[model samples]
Every structure is written in structure tokens, then in C-alpha cells.
Target: MLDGLNLEVPQGQIISLLGPSGCGKSTLLRVVAGLTPAKHGTVSIHGEDVSQARSRLAFVFQEAALLPWRTVWQNVRLPFEIRNQKSRKTIESALKHCLEIVGFQPNDWHKKPSQLSGGMKMRASIARALITDPEILLLDEPFAALDDMLRSRLNDLLLRIVAESQRTMLFVTHNIGEAVYLSQSIAIMSRGRIAELVEVPFTYPRSSELRSAPEFAAFYGRVSEALYRSER
Candidate 1:
């Protein structure tokens, strides 16, 4: 249902898709991820179409979407099992690195999804996405279900991941504060297209204190006004 919508995410930067519910923010992410087909226009990464560049990308959903029956280790390793691309040694090395990156302990690795808390489940999900060592990450409201504190922690985790790995990221969110906090630019969507693109002037490696700053509030207000106009 997108019409004339276009966006370009610069390399190694985060761009957030922000809009009201049902405004096609998630749909746009799906199209970029190749989960949903685009009837017109193209999704490309570094001049290659999405189909060609897919191997370099990874996606994280709102829900952990982990199999209830699988333990955290099993779930995180599922991509390797499906792709069968890496050797056992490489896979194990990757699993260890990804788990460490997401701050998971050895004891929690054997637990099933049912046994973990909400934040822990998200950590597993993020670790699963990282197993592939993707260059681009597509996130669809990944922290929406968590409490404020958990959400903030995960947001910081995401920032750290990007800083360390230099991966380009596209994040979809209904939360304006999140968009301002995480993105270098925010694309505000409405009626199936980008209504406005707002730049976040704040520098990266931003702390939680940035959210309480006067400049942050001013940028937030600007984005809010743009969103209101888009909805009208």
C-alpha cells in the first residue's frame, strides 16, 4: 500500500521510521527486509537489490518469537542450522561471542523461552539476530513490550552494538522519544509515505541523560509537530 515512499539509510548509521499505528512503519521495514514484496519501486542495499543483498541483513521482531520448546542456545543457533553455511567450530565461536555481546550468562543459555523474563527473552532474540554477523539490522519495535527501565537498557544495548560493530540499522517505532534517542534521522510516515524527515542533531554514544536535556526536548517537539501535521 506504499505510494511513492523512498528512504535512504547511510552506511553505519541508524535511521528510525516513526509514525502512528497503521501508518505503514512496520510494513516499510518488512518490505526492506524482503519479508513483504513491493509491487513497485525497489529495495536495494549498496546498489544491489534486496534479494541479492539479503544475506548481509538480519531482522528482529517486536516479540522475541523464539520457539517455546527450544532453549536459548538452540534458538540462537537456529540460523546456522537452517543455512548450514558455517562449520561447527565457527558456529560455536559465533554463539559465544554473540551471547557475550548481549550479556547472557551460561546458566541462562539452557533455559527455554518459558523460563526467562521479558528482558531476558529479548536478549536471546537479539543474540539470535547477531549470530549471522549481519551488516544491516532491521528492527520492528523490538522494545515495545518491555517496561521503561528494560526498554532503556535495551536501547543502550543497541547503541553499543552499533558503536562496536558499525552496522547500519533501520528501526521502526511508535515512540517518538526512542526515535530521537536512537536515530541520526527520523522518517515520519503517514498515509503510506514519508511525510517528513527530521534530523537529530545530537551526537552519538548518547547517554540516558540526553533524554532530559533541553535540546532533546526541543527536537522532540519538532518531531511531534511534524507527526501531527502528517496525521492531519
Candidate 2:
């Protein structure tokens, strides 16, 4: 269980929680999403308690977690269906726009989860999360299952979403490289608490070329060192 877990994400900042397996990273994320209650302390999103904050946030899990019976269009429309706060035409328009933002064509919208590739499934998952236009998004290793090339492409998509919409993000990952690519800062967690919070000095709209840069290596080294300490 999370204990004395005091953490915060600034408005519009992307922060990744980096940790070893079972370091409570996922648990911590769940707590932030208000899915798992913290045994101690409060979770405030935008200064509101977790319960009050629920409406302003969206969460994407490690797995796509789409309903097997639903098609892509149906899956992305699920959020709107749950809220039941809009007209059918309005929800359809929002779903279509969200799909476009994630790079899916109208034709692909009819495919079932089984028919889509890993990346496409993730795109749909993200679209579902974005359909509500949440102020903050909690992601739990959404790209971990994909290959490097696919992961890179998804990273680009994620950054584009962040840039265009300026949504605050709290990402959880075991991969240091992924953290380096997507996070403005990395919070290293050990046991049940954060051990260190390291800033990534790189500017946003970062390209794949940054992966090979000396500065990238330098930032990687710093985060790696922090991870090593957390492991100890």
C-alpha cells in the first residue's frame, strides 16, 4: 500500500514515475487515478480531492482493455456512453475527431480490437481517454508491449497530443529510455515511496535524433544513476 506518498504534478507538465518492478509504481498511479485508495494521505488533482477530481481526469492502462465485443468506434464511444451527457450526434462527432487526432481513418473505426495491431489498439485506447478532453491523463506504460519502432512512433503521437492540447500527464514506466523520451521530469520510486525527482533539461518537440545526441546520453546517465540508487 502507498504510505505517506506525497507527490504532485504541475499543471501541463509531463512527469514519469520510474522504478523497479513491484516498487509500487503502478499502485501509486492507481492511487493518483483514484482507483486505489491510499492508506494514508490525500490525493488532490488541481487542488480538489480525488473524488471531486474524477471528472477532470482520464486514465489509460498498460493494456488496451477494450471490450472484446465492441468495435473501435464503439470502444472509443464507450466513455461518452457512460457519461450520457451528450446527444448521439455530438458524441459521434467527438469520437470521430478524437480518432483523427490519434491518426485513425474512418474505415479503421469499424474494426474490432482483435483485427487491429498493437499500435492501433493503443491509439484507440488513447482516443477513448481523450474523448472527454480531460485536464490530466494518467498513463500506465501504454506502449510497453510494442516493439521499439512502434513505441517510438507512439511516443511521437503522445508528444504531439501533449503539445497541441497541453494536457498534464503522469506516466508510469519501467523503461528508462521511454521515460527519457516522454517525461519533463522523472520520479524514481523505491519500495513504496519516491526516492528522487530528476528534471530533464531537454526542450519539448524532441525528435528521434535526440536519442543519439550526447546531451541525451548525459540525461540518460543521470536518470540511470538515480534509478541505480533507488534500486539499492
Candidate 3:
């Protein structure tokens, strides 16, 4: 249902799509992830069409959706289970690095999803996404299910991960505060199209303190204005 939607996400930046529910936010992420093919338009990653560039992308959904039968280590290693060309050492190294990036402790590795807290499960999900070391990461409200405090903690963790990896990211979220806190720019969508894009003129290392800053309020107002206008 995307209507002539055209967006250019810059390299190595976190850009968020903010819109009401069912306004094609998730649809847009799915399209970009190559999960849902676009019939009329082309999706290109790094100048190559999706079909040719899919290997360079990774996606994380709101729900961790880990297999109930798998342990944390097994869940994070799920992507590698499908391919067998890699040596055990290489796979172990990749899993170790991705797990550390998402702050997974060694003790938590053998635990099942039912044994882990909600946040821990999502952390495992993120580790699974990062194990591939994708160039472009597409997230569809990955932290939306968590409570406010947990969500903020995860947001900080995500920012650290993004800064460390420097991967290009396209994040979809309905939370204005999250969009403002996490993205360098916010694309406001309404009625199946992008209504506007607003740049958040803030530097990196932004914390919860930024939420109380005057500049943060100004940017929030600007994005809110765009969102309000989109529904008109």
C-alpha cells in the first residue's frame, strides 16, 4: 500500500520511519528487507538490486520470535545452521563477537528463551541479526514491546551497537520519543506515503538527558508537527 514512496537512506546512519499503525511502516521495512517484493519499484542496496544484494542485509522484528526449543547459544547460531561452508572456529568467533556486541554474558548462553527475561530474548534476537555482520540493518520496532525503562536501556545499547558497527540502518517505530532519540533523521509517513523527512540536528552519544534538553523539545515539536500534518 505504499503510494509512490521514495526514500534514500544515507550510508552508515540510523534513519527511522515514524507513522501511525498500519500506515505502511512495517510494510516499508519488509520491502526494504526483501521479504515483500515490490511489484512496481526496485529496491537497491549499495547500488545493487535487492536480488543481488540481499546477502548484505539483516532484519530484526518487534518480537524476538526465537524458537522455543532452542537455547540462547543455539538461537543465535540459527543463521549459521543453514549454511555449512564455514569452519567451526570461524562460526564460533562470529557468534562470540555478535553475542558480546549485544551484551550477552557467557552464563546466559545455555539458557532457553523461557528462562530468559523479555529483554534478554530480544538481545538474543539482535545477536542473531548481527552475527551475519550485515551492511544494512532493518528493524521493525524491535523495542516496542518492552516497558519504558527497559526500552530506553535497549535504545542506549542499540546506539552503542550502531556507533561501533557503523552500519546503515532503517528503523521503523511508532514512538515519537524513540524516533527522536535514535535517528539522525525521521521520515514521517501517512496514507501509504512519506509526508516529510526531518533531520535531528543532534550529535552522537545522545543519552536520556537529551530528552530534557531544549533542542530535543524543538526537534520533537518539528517531527510532531510533520506527523500532525501527515494525517491532514
Candidate 4:
């Protein structure tokens, strides 16, 4: 039920969608991911429409969504198996790099999802998303289920990954601070449309200490105000 929504994310930058519940944030992500169809409008990535750009994108859901029976390695390798775009040797090589990027130790690779902690499961999910080497990454509240400390840690991990990979990302979150901390810009949505786009003035490689700074608090307040106005 989106209403004339349009957004343009710069190459290699992260854009977060922040809003109240049922404002179509998750639905927007789904539309861009091509999981949900739009009645009108076109989604373009890297100058190509979504259908043409599908192979260059990857998505990470709120839940890890790893198969219960699969080991960590198996879960991360699932994309390659489904796509059949790479040879076994190539996939094995890529799997090693992806797992290492997400901070999975060699020993933990054989463990099933039930044996892993929530954070570990998310790491596996991110690893799975990275396996495809996508140009754009779409995330739907990927950290909502984790505790504060763990979420902060993974936030740092995600920033590091983005720095190294330079992938464009669209992240959806209800937390103002998290949205401010992670995105280059925040798009505040209301009633199925973008109400405001706020630029984050801080440079990247932002540490957790940034969250404690006065400037960060000011920006967070600004975003919160924007959200409040949107809802009203």
C-alpha cells in the first residue's frame, strides 16, 4: 500500500528506513527485494530495473532463517547450491572468505543452528548474504532480536564488512539510534510514503563511542523529531 514512494541510494552507501509499525517499511524492503510485487513503479539497482538487477542483490531477514538441520557451513553455502552458478571448488573458496568475514571460527562451522547462540545465527545469516557478493544488500530489522550489547557488537561488525566490501545497503529499523548509527541517510516513512530524508553528518568507521557523544544524541533527537512529525 505504498503511496508514490521514491528513494535513491548512492553507490556504496547505507540508507535506513525508519518509521512506526505498519507504515510499509518491511513491505517496501520486500518490494525492492522482488519478494513482493508492486502494482506500479519500477525498482532499479545500478541503473537496471529489478528484474535485470536481481542477481546483483541479496537480502537478510530479521530472523536468521537458517535451516534447523543444516550446519553453519551448509547454511552459508545454501545460496550457491540453489543458484548453481559456481563450481564446487569456487563455492568452497567463497564460503571460507564469507565465514571469516562474519567472524565464524573454523570449529564452529560444523555446528547446527540449535547449537549456536542468537548472535552466531545472525552471523551465519550475514555470511549467507555475502556469499553471493551482491552489489546491494537489503536488511529487514536484522538486529531487533538481539540484546543491546550483542546488537552493538554486530553493528560494528556490519560497518566493518561494509567498509571492506563497499556494498550499497538499505536497512529498515524502528530504533532511531540504530538507524542514525548505521546509515549515511535516514528516510522517515509514514502512511506508505517517505516523509523526510535526513543526512547523517558523521563519517564512516563510526565507533560505539559515537553513540555516547553529544552530537550523536543531537542527530538522534533530530531523527526522532522527524519521525514524530511524520506520524502526526
Candidate 5:
């Protein structure tokens, strides 16, 4: 059972859940997405309980999760299509905006999932998540498959998207450095529970300079210590 997960996720901020592999970070995201049963806690999004917050949340899984049979545009359009809704010009505009923000060119939208590289596929996955205009986005190691350079690029892309959309996000990552880079706050999980929640307290557009900042080193130390203690 998940124990004592109480914490505040400020609206329009990005909070990452970080832990080692085999920890329950992804499981937490799944539960928050309502894909699995949340045993005892209430999830609130925008002051509304999420269990009752239907049609208000979006989930982006790792592995792109795109359908091979569908082209990229069709795949991104699934949220509208699944609800028996027609795509509006406004909706297409939103999709195009999201794709452009994630660095997809015009020709990229027509390609199938199989035609895209790992990074492109993940970008398409992100586009699909944002297309619905979700207030809260749950991302599960969405860039883990890409190389370090690509992952850093996507990290910047993700931060830009978050800024543009002003969407709150719960990101799950096994990478410590990435947690510091992308998150304003971090919940370090262990054994189905959050061991510590630390605020980053850094300003937005967190530059590469922060990597050498004293605050950065201090926060990293605290997170490392928390994880080490959680293991015992």
C-alpha cells in the first residue's frame, strides 16, 4: 500500500517523482491517471478531486504508446476521436501548436510511429498528451529511451511546453540530475511511498549555471541523503 502521500502540488508547476528503478514511480503515475485503483488517497487537480475530475487529466506514458497503424496526426487526434467527437479547426490548431513546440516539422506530422526515431516518437507522444489541453499531465520517464544529448534537448522542449501550456505535471524519473533540471519540486519515492518532498526554489528557465550553484549542490545533497536513508 502507498503510505502517507499527502503533499501539495502547486498549480502550473512541474513536480517530479524520482527514485531508483523498480521503485513505484510509474505505478504512482498510473494510479493518478485513474488507470489503476488508488487505494486510500484523494487526488485533487485544480481543487477538484481527481476521482471525480473526469475529462480533466491527461497521461503520457513511456515508449511513445503510439498506435503503429495510425499516422502521427491521427494518433495525436485520438483523444477527440475516441469520444465520438469531430476534429475542429481549433483542435487542429492546438495539435499543430503542440507539435511545433516539441520541434516537429510539417512533414513529421504525416509519418507513422514506425517511421519516427525514438526521440521523435516520444515527441509525438507528448504532442498527443498536450493536444487534449489537459490541465495536469502525468509523464512516465518519457525520454529515457533517448541518448543523453537527446534527452537534454527534450528536457528543454518539455520545459518550454510546460511554460507555454501552463499545465501542472507529475514527472517520474530515475535520473537524479534530470529531476533537478526539470522539476521545481521533487518527491522521492521508496517502496510505494514518498520519502521526501523537496522544493527546488530556483527561478524558471533554470540555466546550466545552476548546475554549479551552491543551492544546486545543497539540494542534490539533501535528495541523495534522503534516498540513502529511505533505503535503510
Candidate 6:
């Protein structure tokens, strides 16, 4: 992975780290999450080194990794399980809030992982991450396994959830179009180093109208150029 890297995300924005399969996008994500060590450069949230800051964050892994034995509600409440039982009501409220934010209906909560669709499983994964009211969200291609239709829907769902909650999110994705649609800024990486950080500058609720907007095309072109330069 790159050393001496400096990433600056604004207070409440969605920035996707993107590149080809072998680049350090996911590795960097882990670095930011404290899941991987920062051998050199630092990861900061609100101007503080996150490694020691005890960040209020949630990390959604590449695989949904919803413990097969747990019910959907149980999986959502997993983050709070280790805390004192006296906080169960807080846990339940947070669980309900997170699930409902992701459009999970009450009936679906009682079902086991096996009973849900792939899309539903992914939603449950996201719901688990949100149960703690995280200030930061780190997603590692959480929807890459789904069909395009479902992926698009989840993209929208995630944007809504983040916007409503005002969480800072750093998402890692290989899909360039998804990056354009979901991120306010994008970091292009290659050979374990970031080549560029391009800002879309377009405000959210980013809509389909943006697809034909000139600024969208221009920003897409710039991001494409950065990624291409990285390949060479």
C-alpha cells in the first residue's frame, strides 16, 4: 500500500476510493477503519488521528457476512450485544431505527439469513452497521454481488440513509459508474497509490437528471482521465 498518503474528506460527504482489482482501494479502506495498521501515513477524522480516536464508525465488509445463525434483528443488534444488558432498550430502538432507514419492514426482521434475498441480505448488513449511529461509514463494495438492478436500488437506498443521517462515508468500489452516482468526491488509485482526488461538486439528492448534465460528463471525464493515467 502507499506510504505518505494524505486523504482529506469533508465533514459530511461520501467519497469513494476506486481503482482496478489489485490496487490498494480496499487496503486503504481498512487503514481508515483501523482494521489494518497504518505503517506510515495517518488516517484522520475531524482532524484527529482515527487510529487512537475511538471513532464512532461502522464497517460493512465485502461479503455481507451476516452470521448464518442470527436472525435479521439479531444481526442488526450485534454491535450492542457486547455492551451491558441495561442498554437493551437503546439497542432495540437503534435496531429498529437502522432497519427502517434501510426500508426493512417489520416482518422481515424475524427471518433468518437463509430466508432473505441477496439484496435483502446486503440491506441487513448495512442495517447492522447503522445500529450504532455511526458518524462514519466504511463500505467495501457491499453491493457488488447483486444484479445491476438491485445494486442501483441499494445505491439509492444507501444515499438516502447517509443523507438523512448525515454520516461521513468512504466507500470502496471498482465500478466507475457507481462511483459517479454515489460519491461527492472520488479517489483514483493504482499500484497501491492514489493518483488523484476529483470532486463532483454536485449537490445531492443527485438525480437521473444529472446523467445528462454537462458537469456530470465533465467530472466523469476528469475521473476517467485520472484512472487511466494510473493504469499507465
When 4 and 5 are scored with TM-score, the better candidate is 4
Candidate 1 has an lDDT of 0.94
Q: Tell how far residue 126 is off in model 4, in angstroms.
A: 0.2
Model 6: per-residue Cα lDDT over 1-232, one tens digit each = 6665778888689999999997988989888888898877777777788866644878998889999999999888877875444576777788888899888999999999999999999999999988777899999999888898898889989889877888889999998878998998899888887788887777889766676788878877878888998899
| Per-candidate TM-score against the hidden true structure | 0.98, 0.97, 0.97, 0.98, 0.92, 0.93
Better of 1 and 5 by lDDT: 1
Supply candidate 3's per-residue lDDT for 199: 88
Model 3 segments beyond 4 Å from truth? Answer: none
Residues 57-127, model 3: lDDT tens digits: 88998999899999999988888887553688988998888888888899989999999898999999999
The per-model lDDT (C-alpha) reads: 0.94, 0.91, 0.90, 0.94, 0.85, 0.86
Identify the candidate with maximal lDDT.
1
Model 4 per-residue lDDT tens digits across residues 43-111: 887678898788889999999999999999999999998998668789999999999999999999999
Can you write out model 5's per-residue Cα lDDT over 1-232, one digit (the tens) per residue? 5666776788898999999887788988887888888878777776777778857788888889999999998998888888766758877887888788778899989999989999999989998888778888889998888898889888888888887778898999988878988999999898878988888878897766777788888878888888888878
Worst 10 contiguous positions by lDDT, candidate 6: 82-91
In the predicted model 3, the residue pairs found to clash are none
TM-score of model 3 relative to the true fold?
A: 0.97
Off by over 4 Å in 2: none
Model 1 clashing residue pairs (backbone) = none
Per-residue error (Å), model 2, residue 103: 0.8
Give per-residue lDDT, candidate 4, residue 84.
80
